[model samples]
Target: MPDRIFDFEKDFAGSLRCIPMAVRLKLDLVGIKLSLRQWSRLDRDQRGRLLEVPCGGAADRHTIGAMIEEWVTATGGTIDRIDPADSANWSNTNTVPEVVVLQAKGEDVSAPSLSQWRALTDQQRFALIKLTRPGHENKNFVPAMREFGLFLAD
Candidate 1:
């Protein structure tokens, strides 16, 4: 695990408050999926180390899941399962966050499978969500997708 630092000021300033990679890592570590708006509610220190802790590429699904559980336990936040009833509402196009939706506009449009998405760490999923928005620069999108092991068939 390398010392991954997130520059909040440089990356998420003004209208584009992109979710920093560090915070993404923390969200993954915690296991419970979070919206960007939810992430915005966390305190500074909680946000800071999201990138500080080194989660190496060697991390597998089980290891990542366990780490996420541990992080949530230590942080005192309850992890809830996504309700089956709420499945239809999970990615409601009408209710999707503006920033996230913006990232998905105009690309090879195809939604990732639920199982595939679920298998990914929250950080990876978050990165994909952010990158796939409507108006985002395409250059960043492919790199982000590649880094997260997404769109293998393309």
Candidate 2:
């Protein structure tokens, strides 16, 4: 990750642009199963626009999920499920979940406060979680934290 927001076009040209973690979040939030290659074909503006679309509030969950599914299907993808509960709720510390816990394995990392994590954009949190995954060679969680502007220099 970089200090700047990820530019899909520049960074992942001619390659499968959707990383597994991002895909997971996208699927969880949008309730879609988008192919990595299909996602790569989308331009930066498209991706940015998707991120800009807010998907919060209790009343809007179903509506938001439907809109996301529509977008995915229109883009040649499919909506696999409608359950938004599967989405990662990084704001919840009491139930950090097994996958996230596994990611923190072997690292002397402290979980940030809910407010701290919530203050970050979804992408930043997603990057941190992905970088912290077990067996991930990069293990660049620290670097990601700094890059996302979540860490200040001493």
* All models, RMSD in angstroms: 10.3, 5.7
Clash number for each model: 14, 0
**Per-residue lDDT for 15-87 in model 1, tens only?**
2244565444444444457556544554555455454545544354345445545655666665554321222
**Clash-forming residue pairs, model 2:** none
TM-score of 1: 0.36
Q: What does the lDDT read for residue 136 in candidate 1?
A: 46
Indicate which candidate wins on TM-score. Answer: 2
Predictions in order: lDDT: 0.47, 0.52
The parts of candidate 2 lying over 4 Å away from their true place are 1-26, 58-64, 86-89, 94-127, 130-138, 148-154
Residue 119 error for model 2, in Å?
A: 7.2
Worst 10 residues of 2 by lDDT: 1-10
Candidate 1's error at 18, in angstroms? Answer: 5.7
